[model samples]
Target chain A: MAMDRTEEDDNLPRRLLDGCQRDFPLTPRPFGALAARLGTTEARVLDAFRDMRKDGLVGRIGAVYRTNTVGSSCLAAIGVPLDRLDEVAALVCSFPEVNHNYEREHAFNLWFVVTAPDQARRDAVLDAIEAQSGLRVLRLPMLEDFHLDLGFKLSWS
Target chain B: MTPDPIDLRIVEATQAGLPLVARPYHAIAERLGLAPDDVMARMARMQDLGAIRRIGAVPNHYRLGWRANGMTVWDVDDARVDALGERIGRLPFVSHCYLRPRRPPSWTYNLFAMVHGRDRAEATRQADLIRAELADACRAGEVLFSTMILKKTGLRIASAAAE
Candidate 1:
């Protein structure tokens, strides 16, 4: 059923977003290979990708490195006063090590991921955030990943 | 495993994205002063090492019409979390699923799964499906819908990784 839904939405641009989420051709002419698989011209694939990228639909075409494999990172959250939420979130986002920061609907509103060279450095980053914000930061490093990939099959219905 | 200096260079070069060209690897190799074959071989090795999860395009879910992004956390029995997490991770709607340590009193959820939907109602409906899958093992659960993206540039390795 899900497969059928995906097949229904099959097109050059949709395939690029859904099909190429993983196992993207690693050949010399990747665009050519993708074009071959999708039954389109290499130029068409490239143009479609460029357009999607320019439109902010595609973040990037790259490798999704495993967290804590090459470096270290942890998901930490902080509960800030409602009034101070935006100010604190900005402070958290200022750190280069802090890659992803989001304002969620919860008491622990400010959530972010901090990446560093090693465990020691990662801890130091959390500490600095704590010190600067004057609030406790809850560190939740991933213990295990149950999924092999983060690919999502889009529905066009 | 830590990437060697050369592999690190390869990672850094492609971190932003593979070059938009006919021969992307050749482009990376030319810029890094390495052979195209060498670049591809190193990336393949990195993928085997589990250092590179996958090589592909990352779509901006919101821009793709997945507006409701929910980080659904659940409190499950410690003995059953790993098993349940594996099942949850396979769900069509769950983009990411992992087991993280419980921070206690304030934070007791050990399971975190990311679900995307076109709207909040759809996102909630997906969460309910996971709840049904977990059955009695799930003691509590809450979906944290992201209200704003303060920062969202993917990981920066060259600057932070060991030199």
Candidate 2:
């Protein structure tokens, strides 16, 4: 009985996570529909969503665009000097085209993704970054995208 | 495909996020000066055309306890990469897998897979599993752990193109 209760409790968030990650209803009252399906109230569903967002579990309720469908994009990396990492990273982030910029444990420490309306513009931005930072930019455009979906199932342990 | 004025407007309006309310699309329609059904229809069409992958919640893996993420890169034979990439992508633990161009002399990795785990050790373990899975087709591999996320934002194409 205790195990059954625990399982029921665990399924709530799991169901919420799994349900919302794909084809969220386009209805006016989506939460209400979701609540009906989950055997809960709209307020309860909304509350859970709020809590999840607050806890950082949920990034956002939004649309994820297909890669290179909306614009040209490429993965780029630069080997910045340790002392100038921050300055270079800030410079990289200044570009609105650059969406994700991160420091990784590698010789090519600073990496980012640049998105532009066209291939020519994207390459131009890369060249500009290389010239500004005085660093050789390694452009690694996606030859094939195997798994595009980043959403993963949440395991409640 | 170049998006129409209406599509661009919709993207700009909701790029940050859809309002978290009972009638989110209605709210979006109100802001855009369009009817709710029109907004919904356009969104559905965009999704069908693959302009929008999905309308849903994006979970932050780091906050969900998958704190360690390994950006695993592998140097696989270019000829056989498509077949191997497909197999590697089917792995449950691998979230994102892509075949990227390899720049010689500095970079020789053509395959990239992102594996996430609760800790660095777990991430490493997953990378090892991928190594074993690749067998001989994978000539060399390295797992670059992300030290910090300096900036992370959803891509927002300029609505200027609409005009």
True interface contacts reproduced, per candidate: 0.84, 0.78
Clash totals in order = 0, 0
| Candidate 2, CAPRI quality class derived from DockQ | medium
Which structure among the candidates has the greatest DockQ?
Answer: 1
For residue B6, model 1's alpha carbon misses the true position, in angstroms, by 1.7
Worst ten in a row by lDDT for model 1 chain A: A1-10
List model 1 lDDT by residue over A1-157, tens digit each.
1223233333678778878989987789999898777766777788888888999999999888888877789999999999999789888988888989999999999899998867888899999999998999999999999987857777778
For model 2, which pairs clash? none
Candidate 2 has an lDDT of: 0.85
lDDT per residue for candidate 2 within A1-157, as digits (tens), equals 1223345444666678877887788888988888787777677677778788888778788788778876789999999999999999999999888989989999999999998877888998999999999889999998788885746756667
Task: Give candidate 1's error at residue B154 in angstroms.
Answer: 1.3
Candidate 1: segments with Cα more than 4 A from true spot: A1-10, B158-163
What global local distance difference test value does model 1 have?
0.88
Per-model chain B TM-scores are 0.93, 0.89
In the range B1-163, model 1's lDDT, one tens digit per residue, is: 6579889788778877887888999999998899999999999999989999999999999998899999999999998888999999999999999999998899999999999999999999999999999999999999999999889987775363323
